[model samples]
Target: MMQQHGQHGQRDGVDAAELAAELAAELPADPVVPRVEAASVAVNLLWCVPGDVGGSEEYLVRQLLGLGEQASDFVPTLYVVKSFIETHPALAKLYPIEVANLTGVDRRRRVVAEHTWLRRRTQHAELVHHGGGTTPAVGTRPIVLTIHDLQYLTHPGYHSKLKLQYLRRTMPRSVHRASVIATPTDWVRRTVIEEFDVAPDRVVVVPHGVEADIGVEAPSEFELRSVYGLGSGRVIVFPAITHPHKGHEFLLDVMAQHWDDPDLRLVLLGGKGLADQRVAAKIAELHLERRVIRPGRVPSSHRDGLLQLAHAMVFPSEYEGFGAPVVEAMSLDTPVIAADQPAVSEVIGDAGLVLPRDPEAWADALDIVADQRVELIAAGRRRVTEFTAAKSGAALAEAYRLALS
Candidate 1:
């Protein structure tokens, strides 16, 4: 009996050792799973905007920074131009950064650098994400291109001939080369796929995100009136670059009608663009010099304050990839009077007044917005929750995964 017990104990010990050895062998075979958990996939982000300060540049900076803050599965190496680094000095402390000494204004040099220098530098990257409109013409790595809009093709009058030609030639090729195309709105997604003949599955719509709590102390009324010459009146802010497509002329026309009213002021925020000469001419034609205040490119910190101080925000653009101002104004609980376009309508969604492109209609809507301020503010605050960084970041991460797959 004692001998039988000993034999049983020996059998149990052998069986336990065999089970442990089998488990150890399985672990080595699946070493990738453990390493994947330890490290993230490295992606190259091409953020080469040098001179631009428009919504596209803002979107790229905010979204990339947001992704860098949130993404654990993928590590992004931001490749920026020297000017970008100069503009945003704090970026160095946040993420892995590389700078290319390229000028934003020199198209020829930019193209050469992209094809030769930028292309060669990104060889080891798992993928290249082009936040600026164009991608490297020659590259083996898969690309994810963000095309804000096809304004050059849609409204040729809005762009210079050279710019129009450059975009016409390069945009379609970029679309073809991209593994995935990311747009800010569904309207843009459909337009790009249809115009470029790209597969629908290759497109992803990631809307812009607004700050959850944008609380900026506004400059006192005295400061605004004394410094910027924003007169004592019911203020309507139009925050957009003075591009022809932005329909500043229409807003100026409306301002012309309101010129006689001493209590109405129109604050035009943003720097001048190619069509700014035309806009300046129209402002002169209307003799709205005093009634319209052109405080070109207010610092971003003051934007929310400006919006909060406004009685209403007007977006008169005829074309847009996304109406960022509309969302921004809404986030600040400011009433919006926007053009009745697809992108604007989609973003506003009955939260604010959407009127026809007619100046008379917009003028009338602005009047209504002033009266219904309380209701509009509440609606706008609620509407802005739909657009948040968490939502956009998740969609962007999924787009990267799709591109990699």
Candidate 2:
């Protein structure tokens, strides 16, 4: 475990003062105060709005945490908005966090600040890592951009006109500017290279890593019952937001038509999205209002508790860069039954039931999930071992080296 000190401190056993001096020696003389010294990597997190970008937010945080814990040639310092510190207090303790003075919630303001303010802060860094899909028009040179997905291109209708236009304009520029492109899965990596006409060598796949914090306490049974009303029956969790491509309506139909058990309850545990009304209408139309629980974004501990208590996790999303929830469920010993989407199937890798998006097939998978619980859970545990934080950190370090080379 990385030792923590109040606010700013040594990380991964590296002395803060000594590390700073080493970085200073490597960089050219700069007039900026605190004497600007480049960390090996400066992570640009100005685009991340808390709770807004879905799993990608958690994915980035976990990767940073992993990098801190593992041995690496490059060091990372997070340049974030104040809200990021508020959202993830643990990171403040573990990393050398440089909080920007802007509120990241305003997209226009964020974009402006990224180009004008962030450029100065990152001037000395060897490379700037853009965690968000779109990079700023002006950022430090030698960029390593992480494009979570080409969802905006694939599902244009899902995004707003302004966001679509912005992404359409910026994505190409960002890709062309990036020294190396990093994607969470090969599915997304291949799509990026093909769509942008970039060389395969320019893109690298750094899969999402799962490292459960055993020390972090999960909510108790009483808390689950009192808070979410989840103790009446067997719980199947689908933790995706109510987006159209998430296949909530399809899952609802399967539950209404095929799964006849009154005791089986499906918990929808994310914030509302574009498909909220349709999902509500479907629940009402199928008279499943009583069977489906929509808690609509709970605390992380509560989410952990729900997943731990769930009989299984069912990820019916039609698309994903990487089905993190599937890996998360496995890490928590919960069996998984996910849609056979390319990225999801690649992540699952025969560990759990990866079925087609047909109602009957999902129904059959859910039926067998219980009977094969022991074996499935064991396989899931084994599968999860492949995507550890240490391994992810190593891959990221290699990517950083490639960016410099």
Candidate 3:
């Protein structure tokens, strides 16, 4: 818990200022900031948009902290440079480096990232070299970016045009300005190299870590199923946000082909997106209403319950930087059936069943899974153990060291 201090002289155990000071005092050490003469290795995670965590962007923040903590252990003061440091004065102390003036620079950055001068406007270079001095740059120190995916640049329709335009401009600039570039998957690394035209050597591939916020005591399988109005039967789970690129339509098509079996059920856990209305209409049109369930946006905690309830997790998507749900389900001893997409395949490897991206493949897959539930669940849990946080964080730390050295 944090203590707060207001200007009115009121002091509370949770005052924001006390919280900031506490953060400043309680961090692990590193030497990266100290080794660089007069310089600070500040990381730029300002764009870690909300809702990115616990789903796909989990690794980005954790690795930043993990790498930053490691760097601080050797470097000295490693402030977690942010624009909103004032909002949580307690968190401001988290940044041993320095916060940059992140205001109004979006337009300026857009120009540089897109037009491509690769100019010597390397003001951030000195900031890194000067211990962040009195004032931060237009961005934070070390200027590192965790490129989760290049969906906007590659597949524009996945998001809005404005966001795509923003990514179109800011990403290249961020890439160019970034002293270090990290990605969650090898496919994303390659994509960055090809799309941003960066040297393949500069982009670092660090696989994403799973949610470590689970208990050692596995929950009751029977109770878990009952929570979702399900019974001890074969379950194929697809936990994805409802989006077109997510291949929800294809997943539904797959389910429709096999919705008749009393032994099987397709449970979808995601929020309604642009395609939800149509997907619902299609369900009604196809008359398969009772066969599937869309309970919407299951929290990470509740997700554990879902996995315990599920016999198998099916990742039906067109692409991703990393399929978080697949690994998450695996961690809970849930077997997986991830589509053979590049990112998905890279993460799941041989741990789970890899099916082709064909729309109708679920029928055959479900039929096989119906009979082999126990073995599938066991194998899935075994696979998830490979993606432990220590392993993932260590790999990320190595990438940070390589970037700095």
Which one wins by lDDT: 2 or 3?
2
lDDT of 2 by residue, 209-263 (tens): 8765831578786778678766578888999888888999999999998886898
Scored by CA lDDT, what does every candidate get? 0.69, 0.78, 0.56
Per-residue lDDT tens digits of candidate 3, residues 209-236?
A: 6646553455566765676766566676
TM per candidate comes to 0.85, 0.89, 0.70
CA displacement after TM-score superposition, residue 91 of candidate 1 (Å): 3.5
Could you tell me the lDDT of residue 334 within candidate 1? 89
Q: Residue 277, candidate 3: how far off, in angstroms?
A: 2.0
Candidate 1's residue-wise lDDT over 222-317, tens digit each? 776677777677788999877777889988887776435777788898877657899989988878887888888876656667787788999988
The candidate with the higher lDDT, 1 or 3, is 1
Winner by lDDT: 2
Q: Residue 404's C-alpha lDDT in candidate 3?
A: 63
Q: Between candidates 1 and 2, name the one with more favorable TM-score.
A: 2
Query: Which of the two candidates, 1 or 3, achieves a greater TM-score against the reference?
Result: 1
Model 2 Cα displacement at 404 (Å)?
1.2
Worst 10 residues of 3 by lDDT: 1-10
Write down the worst ten-residue block by lDDT for model 1: 1-10
